[model samples]
Target chain A: MNWYRKLSIKQKQVVWAWTFLALPVLFYVVIRFYPTFGSVLLSFQDWNLLGSKTWIGLENYEKLVADPVFWKVFNNTFIYLLLGTPVSLLISFIIAYHLDKVSFLHATIRAMYFIPFMTSAVAMAWLWRWFYQPVPVGLFNNFLASIGISQLPFLKSTFSALPSVLAPAIWAGLGFQIIIFMAGLRAIPQSYYEAAQIDGVGPWTVLREITIPLLKPTLVFLVVFSSIGFLRIFDQVFNMTTNDPGGPLNSTKPLVLMIYDTAFNAFDMGYAAAQTVVLFTILLLVSLLQLYVMRERT
Target chain B: MKSWKKTIIGATAGAVMALSAGFAQAVEIEYWQYFYEARVTAIDTLIEKFEAENPDITVKHTTFPYADYRTKVAAAIPSGQGPDVVQLFYGWLNDYVEAKLITPLPTDAFPPAMIEKEFFPMVQAMKKDGAYMALPTAVRSLALFYNTRLFEEAGIDGPPKTLDELVEIAKKLTKKDAAGNITQVGITTGMNAQDHHWWREVLTRQFGGDPYKDDYKTVNYNDEAGAAALKWYSELETLHEVTQAGFMDEGQAAFKAGRAGMHIDGSFRIGALKSTRGLKWGVAELPAGPDGMKSNYSSYWVNGITSKATGEKKAAALKFLAFVTSDEAMQIWLDTVGELPAKPSAALTDANKADPVFGPFINGLGYAKTTIFANESGQRQVIMDAMQRILLEDQSPADAVAVAAEAEQKILNEYYK
Candidate 1:
């Protein structure tokens, strides 16, 4: 008890700071940091979930580099990011811009758009899959057939599968992005828009000169956020094309799904860890690249 | 009044003591399975009976979704928290054996001679390292399920007997609108997953090629015959225009909805198919290949004790397993789940064989082959992809098979190594 009173004020402050940080620091070490290091170490080893782990010294990585499926999944993960981010951002921004001016049932309309984001990804994937089925069973095909148009294969054809999967993914993410955009729009001073109106400036000109410039922060944040979301996409692709996951011929397969299949289905933990390390590197690089690209001009 | 109070106190103490004693003496063993309505109900009833019979032991039941079951088991068993007794697909036997996750049955309890005499030939799947690692209550084999009304409407007199006849009948049965959209499908094949299973287990055999060789260590389906089978399976979609890969939610949905004429499925689906309102369906033996070679698949889900269980828990699990695979449980499974009994004596009885809906599957027991593929799901995906390349990407079947064989061979090579 007497030892407690012997500490200096600076020491006491240090002790308190560490005491407050201790729980989170311990948590990060145990839950987050431990697994990260373990996976990195495992990347260089060979272990099937059941057997003893062996030190293969980069053999798993060599295999990954040589694997054709890994390359396809790598290309797919990027396509998801490149296509999903810009398309969804444009859509949500457009919806939020128009929705901000509407007075009637504003909350209801906003809630309707946001509901999909809150809904289960598995359910959403299955629903979208149902909509993509052939003529007699699928909604899209039936509607097309009724309108005297040819039934287009949404999920069956390899050329159409990646984009078809991207549509549902983009839809599922719009609600949160729209809410952020709306908040950004709301924060902009109304007087700027009023002045622009008094000067006889049109909506498009005001949007271009003032709104877009002011909303750049929100835009940049969402672009990075949505890009990561798309890059790590698994549930939609897994659930929709579950009969043969990763899409037909792996057209819709992403990196994370490949990691899951490798780890769980194949039980190749070391190989799976290597793939996960690769995914982690890609995510880090992409996020950093986006942040650098969107840095302030001044 | 004092006497009455003493009596009540004494009785309360005794009751509390009895309850605690019961809790202390009871042993609990958990049983795990994938979610299936009929399978669950049948097992629940059997578990109730088991608990009643063995007063000192309690059994807890757990079920995960079908797609996640194997993964959950693989993760759980290694963590020391898996179920004491587990129901696993027979295809996983090799993986489990290699991983040392499950123990072989004691010979005293399940003697090899007894097993050979009692169970069907597929029981060979349970033997690893010259001992039985698992035992099953029910077994299933794929059979041809055709919509009777659809066949009659299409002017087909009988189910096709050969692969070429199937193509002809499927072409006749397919119904298309003026816009060239298929309204009714003849069969479910092409890139669909079921197509791959049928191809690997049935068509590959018919085409005189095997999926794997040398104790499942070599990929044997990369040759001309494999290419011919894959090409034939895809012809249902491309050549005949009968059904495309995306025709229904899957093959079974098409048959249930009366939109498909012929579907290849296991006897496990009979209970559900029988209840489909206003649908007239009939089961036939799977058609032979071009060479008139007959082959079919027998897939079984067996219950085995995990290696994590030991001592008293292991003993209790064995008792549970014995009860589950006994004649009574087999009868219960046959009556309720619409699956063939794994026990040869139980299944080959005249009364059971006379059953029209289940008869074909039971008869298939004679020739059905149970594949010991280590990762059935992964291998299925490989074949499905090969089919997709042929149908959607216009890849030649020979090239597609070569590619699939290369990928599948990689998996086998790793396993064997």
Candidate 2:
């Protein structure tokens, strides 16, 4: 106790601060960081869950590189990210922009948009699956038939399956993105828009010069966040294609689904770990790239 | 009055403590299976009987949804947890053995000769290195399920006996709208469903081709006969236009909706079909090929003692397993689950063979073949992809068969080698 008293005030404050930080730091190490490093190590070994792991350095990686299905899945993951992020961003922005002006039943309409985000992904995917089914059973197909238009094979064709799957995914995410955009829009001071109006600038010019420029930080954050979400997509695809997961010639199969199939279905833990490592690297690179590109420049 | 009330509470607590002390000495083991209502009820009844016979032993039953059951077993076993006796699909037995998740049944308790003499020959697929790794309580075989109302509406007397007649009947039963869209299909075809098994075990054989060579380690369905089978199956959609793929989402769903004339499904479907209101369906033997060849696919869900079971738990698990596979349990499963009994003694009775709904499925067992799967889902995916290529991409039947064969061979080599 005397020794603690002898310490300087700064040192005492440092000791108190670390005492509070100790628990969460320890938690992050044990719960998060430890398994991450373990998975990285397992990527170089050959294990089938129950069997003893044998070191087969880089072999799983080699096989992954050569596997055509892995490449196709990698392409699909990027497609989800590229297509889902921008379309969701634009649609949500448009809705939030228009919705900000509407006062009648405003809260109720906003709540309606947010409901899908709260609903279960599995339920939403199944609902969308029902909508996409062929005529006499499906909603979309029946409507088309009623209108005298040829029925579209929404999920049956390789060309249409990925987009059909992406549609619901983008829609499910709109609620959350709209909420964020509205929050961002609300944060922008009305004085700037009033100034633009005083200058007699058009609405488009005001949006381009004031609103969008001010909304840059929010856009960057959402871009990174939603990119990661799309990259790691699993539930919607898994549930929609439950009968033939990643089917129609693997058109809708993403990297995460491949990892799941390899790990649980095939019981090839080593290969799955290798795939996980690749996914982790891809996620890290994509996030970093987006951040770097969107970094503030003076 | 307060003291009297306290005394009553104290006495109740004491009695509970004593009962728990008795339970503490009993060996407890868990059994897990995928949740199906009838199977769950059947197992609960068996558990009640097993406990009554052995009051010193206690058993706990667990079930998960079919989608997550295998994953739960795989994760739990290596951690020395979950299910002393676990139920697994017979196709997954090889994976379990290779992963060391299950232990071989003791030959002393389950002699190989007795198993061969009593159980159907198809059960031999469970044998590895002269030891039985698992035993099933019930077995399943494929049969043609025809909607009686649809047949009557089409002016057909009965189900077709040959493949050519099947096509004729299907074409007759089909209905179309003014826009050339199919309103009612002659039959349902989806490779994602039982059609993969039908093509591999029945059609391929009937077309004079073996699906696999060398105990299913090599893909041999790349030949002319295999291509012919593929062509015929796909032509049901392309040329005949009697059936369509993905109609009403699934083949069974279409059949159940009374829009399909015929559906090929396993005996396990009988229980569900029976409960579907207004569905007038009858079972028949699968249509024969042009050469009069008949074939069927047999499969089962088997119970095995996990490696986690040892000593007292192992003994209890074995006792429970033996009871579940006994003749009495088989009868209960057949009654509740509508699956055929695993053993000839229980399944070959006159009543089972003569019953209208069960007779066709029972007759199929005599000519059934079980494929020793290296990777069942992967192999199924190969066939499904082939079907999709033909239906969607205009790929030739020969090319699709060759691609599927090569893809399946790679999976087989990955496992066996």
Candidate 3:
């Protein structure tokens, strides 16, 4: 009691700040920190989820390097990020830009676009799978056939498979991204557009110079957010190719799916943990790289 | 004096009734299984019957969806908690035994000699180190399930018995639109993406070559027979042009719609085919490979007792197991589940043998072989990937098989180590 009374004002503020921070701090330690470090430790050990873990050190990493499937899946993960993010981002921005200017049935139209994002990913993946099927079966193929178009092997061919799987994923994400872009568009001052009009600058010019420059923060946030989502993509690939997940010679298999297969299907926990660590490193590097590249100049 | 004597007798009788009630509190043992409509109903029915038969032993049943069944069981069993009697796929039998998660049924309980004498040859897969760790009530084997109406439309008399005849029938049955688009396929060869089982388990055997040898440690499919089998499978799409990748939609779409002339699938699909209205289908033994050998893949999901079950709980679990594997239970399982009885005596009845639909699957089990997959799911995917190369990417069957063999060999080596 005497020591508590002896504390200065600065000391009291420090203690108060920590008192408020206690729960979240404890949560981070238990829920986040523990598993993370445990996984890292586990990457260096062999475990079958049923046996005692043995320290095998670097062997898991060595095997991963030699594993051909890992390389294929690594490329697939990047393809999801490289292709999915930009394509979805562009589509969302276009919709949002046009949508912001609209007055009639704006809410309804916005809701329509947002519905896909809110729908369950697994259901969306399966629905798109049906859409990608060939003639007399798929809606897309039937429509093509009715109009005298060759049936596209959307989900079957290795060349077209990733994009086919990616299409629904991009579509599913558009609603959320569009909503974000719309919010950002709405936040911009009307005065800038008015001034640009007075200057007789064209709409495209204003869009490139003012609207985009002002929306940098939102763009950065969304880019980082969607990039991570694409990087960790599993459900879409898993459900769409449920019959042959990551198939057509593993053209659609991603890092997360590979990690899952190694852990559960193969019961190679050590190898899976190694893949997880690689995924973590990739996520970290990609985010950092994006942040650095997109940094606002001083 | 007479009234006093009567009261004493009544009190003694009452005391005896109380003592009996105390002893009959019921020993409850829980059973866990994967959720399929038929499976759930069958288990519930068995529980009702078993409970009625053993009034003192109460059996509680719980189920999870198929996808999560193995993971749920694996996680729960290690904590000394979970069902006393659990259902496991044969692929997982080795792992469970190795981990000591399941107790091998006491030799005294089901003598080793009795096992060989009574059960089908496939039941040997249930054993580890000459001890029966788990036993299945029902077993399944792959068979060629064809749409009978489609065959009639194609002007085919009956199911083809050999690979050459199948190709001839496929060419005849196929239909095309004006633009060269395949509107209806003659045969949806189960050789695309996920349909690798037909190629690996059944065809590999019928082609007169084994998939693995030296205790599943080495890949033995690098020879002439394996390549020939794979080449024939690839040619179905590449050269034959009768069955395309899109024909099946990679999800049994073509078969269910009756657009496919022939489908090679397991007996497990019988319920679905039968339930689909406006569809007439029949099951036949898979067409023989070049060597003229008939082979099929047989896999079983067995009920295993956990090591944690002990004393009275162990006794109750054993009672449930015995009841479920009994001839009566096997008959009920056969009638309800559309799977063959595991016991040879129970399955080989004249009525069952002569039945048109179920006959092929039952008879195919004579030469059927269960997978020795250490990681069955993983190994299946590896082989499937190999099939995809030949079917989709135009890779040579020899190269594809070799690559797949190497990958599978690695998995096997890792497991044994």
> Highest DockQ, which number?
1
What tens digits encode model 2's per-residue C-alpha lDDT throughout B328-393?
Answer: 999899888899999989999999999999889989999999988877888899999999999889
The residue pairs that clash in candidate 2, if any, are none
lDDT of 1 by residue, A1-298 (tens): 5766899989889989999999999999999999999999999998877667889998999999998889999999999998999999999999999999998999999999999999999999999999999879899999999999998888887889899988999999999999999999999999999999899999899999999999989988998899989999999999888887887888999999999998888888999999999999998998899899988885
Which of candidates 1 and 2 is the stronger one according to TM-score?
2
What is every candidate's alpha-carbon RMSD to the true fold? 2.5, 2.0, 4.6
Model 1 chain B — which ten-residue stretch has the worst lDDT? B188-197
lDDT: worst 10-residue window of model 2 chain B: B92-101
lDDT of 3 by residue, B208-255 (tens): 788778766777987777887888877877788788765646436688
In model 1 chain A, the worst 10-residue window by lDDT is: A45-54
Cα interface RMSD of each candidate? 1.7, 1.6, 1.9
Q: Each prediction's DockQ?
A: 0.67, 0.63, 0.49
Error of 3 at A286 (Å): 1.7
Error of 2 at A37 (Å): 1.3
Write down the TM-score of model 2's second chain: 0.95
TM-score, ranked from best to worst = 2, 1, 3
Deviation of model 3 at A294, angstroms? 2.5
